[model samples]
Target chain A: MTDRAFAVVRAGALTSVQDRGRPGHAHLGVPRSGALDEPARDLANRLVGNPLGAAVLETTLSGCAVRPRCAVTVAVTGAPCRVTVDGRPAAWGAPVRVAAGAVLDVGSAADGVRSYLAFAGGVACEPVLGSRSTDLLSGLGPAPLTHGTVLPLGPVAGPPVYADAVPWQGPPRELVLRAGPGPRTDWFTARALRTLVTAVYRVSPAGNRIGLRTEGPPLERAVDGELPSEGMVLGAVQVPPDGRPVVFLADHPTTGGYPVIAVVKERDLAAAAQAAPGTPLRFVLTERR
Target chain B: MSTMRVLPAGDRALLVELGSGEEAEAFHAELLRRRARGTLPAVREIVPAARTVLLDGLDDPARFAKGLADWEIPALVSGAGSTVELPVRYDGPDLAAVAELWGVPAGEVGRIHARTPFRVAFCGFAPGFGYLTGLAERYAVPRRSTPRTAVPAGAVALAGAYTGVYPRSSPGGWQLIGSTDAVLWDHARVPAALLTPGTRVRFVPEEG
Candidate 1:
């Protein structure tokens, strides 16, 4: 791999490289830690013409500002971040080609909470355990990108430019989600989850890579006894004694003790990942097989 | 009345409940047997818990259900099974604390930890991590009230009915009793994780 540099002009709170994430090791207790906004990440990559699973940047809470070492083309998607290249405004949901040494800045969006940046080729980081995504919870890959960190990019095949949208936009929800039965649904109080799925829940400010705290009707567990620690999965809605359901996300641990009442559908994950604080969500159970 | 039910979880996963822990164990064993014989289709992984099993598979639910219906329950492994010895250094910060809570000698904790071989119960959460069950009764200790922000890799810990080693450094609430140098997960390895369900493990005190 050739060494390159793409300086972070203004690194926001959290900016890290991510790919499709490490999969196929669930038996080993590993979470499939990757891009939080999967669809946005995919769309950005496609716009820049990178492979579907190629590594891209995941900027969380706040946004980021970047400057390529040489002439490079890139795309931005997710969280609707307000973007500008070399002080000239650019649009989200599209790609932009920059001349050599052009500076690109990403600012927080009025709507969502995270943004994805895809290079024409892909963000080339030293892959750890078959993925380039940063597993902050596991400390498995490169640390989050900082202001001075120079990211290396690989060679691209064509000129940088924006592409038209394809036909794959997902469900439209204020807080998008698809639901499924959890591993320990039997532990939940009868109809407790029905209330959860039908009621509107607000995202508590207490949210991070591990899980999202939500405020709604308290979900009661049937068996009061402590559960032996067991395996967990991304999107698992775990209820602790406090009653608020914590939805596990990308950097979740391998196992937990609290009862999990539901799992968010994989396709609905992107919307949840980009949910801003106070966003209200309502889970609609589906007959989808 | 049946106390549990099987439900479709997603496009590629299912949640099967067997009521009690014993029933879950039996069902998991049968599923494992079917998996080994290549009789199960579409299933990518089968994770067993105290009373349920989460089956993740390639995106075909109908085919997976068919495979489940066709599985034949197999006999459990009898007598002494294959055992792999592991060297563990009994110097974790929580070892003495856990021993005192158990009303046992601190040094005796190590001996008890090694007394009986533990079996891999299930795997999930992160890659190459294993949930080991069947710890000796005396060694059982509740998890810490507050989890550590970061538990170093290879740290061996126990909580409730299970004990495990942290595959990578992360936040944890388990009571750490020891550590091991063995690599539980190496991405380059043909099969990354060392422990799979039913694999037996014995911890030998490290000499240093």
Candidate 2:
């Protein structure tokens, strides 16, 4: 818990501390920047008995190497990463106890994209804007973890409270987003909403924290018009002047001008969060009944 | 005139467009009032734009088009919001260029900025950032053709008829006129945002 100095001996593609992201700040221009793979992060945290939102290491596919300075229990979940402790093979998705100076190595995932390493306590870095998650677009949290970086773990008492290991996998192939209508629906022509559901849109390479730009038949508005810039939310599907549809993701702008064809359901956001580039996405219309 | 137009934004949020810049302002006021009284719905967040308000909660996004028909629209009050005085240095690189464009002395730009209190018309572009309207007609500056990759935190910038403060370090296209020391957001504090939708904000010259 308290007396811990965790250091990154080697970093792979990406490594950043992420807890649950800061929400309800979009009106202030902040995105709900957090773990893109929410389920994995949550599972990893639970394995180590960390608090519900304890900070975990969100390592991209390449993975990372870490050296802990104290006794700890850690687990890696999300994307399938090869994990090992001091040259001994370690099972992924399960907790492992480590003494001081033990080196934990995480390779890359074969099936999925992101892997989160959670500690028994938690990563205790400076919390910015009410969350430990890093917003690379906003510079809201600490920089990405690099080699030779030493991280401090939060305080934990007594024994670890581990959860029964239940393996889970993110949605594969086309992600189905449940949505509702938006402000500029009039901007679209007939069957616009139907097209969103019926048509299969390919995720564009231009996707990022801001939004997921997709390739589909240009959505025709009933009235081709301009919308005054207005407040936007995560999961908002905005159609730009080019006629292509772009679904606002975790780091969406506070406002936008394009007509919204539909919005993704809140519960389904995690599926979209882990979608890699070029993944196909489909839309479905549903009510809260 | 106040008009309610509700539309769905994706499957996540609800967008309500209220006609009249005046009505948008009033709706912001009413939102704060309801929030204070704790009668607001399970809305996670509500954002007010120039003439629209986005509501996000567990509400059915499909039913949003119908929800606007039932909301009690608030009355607009042009100058009724609380006034917050912000101190600025007015030393941004674009200050002189902006003044020259307006055919006035660079120092006068600060005067024009502080001439009247600005209303928080909306928050967009970035987090906790506010789009404060009510700039003097003469000082309305167009946005830079190409935005800077990184604008410093607390930077007070202007674009066209909108004046705004950058809450965090971000890329921006607005003309930076000055900087402020007030912390617009801090995660450690309760109610992280410094300027809510209805709060008034004013700019004052800060000497450092």
Candidate 2 wrong stretches, greater than 4 Å: A157-165, A191-195, A215-226, A241-243, A286-289, B10-12, B59-74, B77-81, B89-92, B95-108, B136-139, B152-155, B167-169, B178-194, B206-208
Residues B1-208, model 2: lDDT tens digits: 3366666665446677777666877776777777789866567777788888787764565554554455675576656757678778788878988888789999898888877678777777765677787776666788899999999999988887788888888888999888888787776677666776766888888765
DockQ of each: 0.45, 0.62
Predicted chain B of candidate 1, TM-score versus the true chain B: 0.83
Docking class of 2: medium
lDDT of 1 by residue, A36-107 (tens): 888888888888877788899888767899888876778888877678888899867777877667788888
Give the range where candidate 2 chain A is weakest over 10 consecutive residues by summed lDDT. A156-165
TM-score per candidate, in order? Answer: 0.86, 0.86
Candidate topping DockQ: 2
* Maximum-lDDT candidate: 2
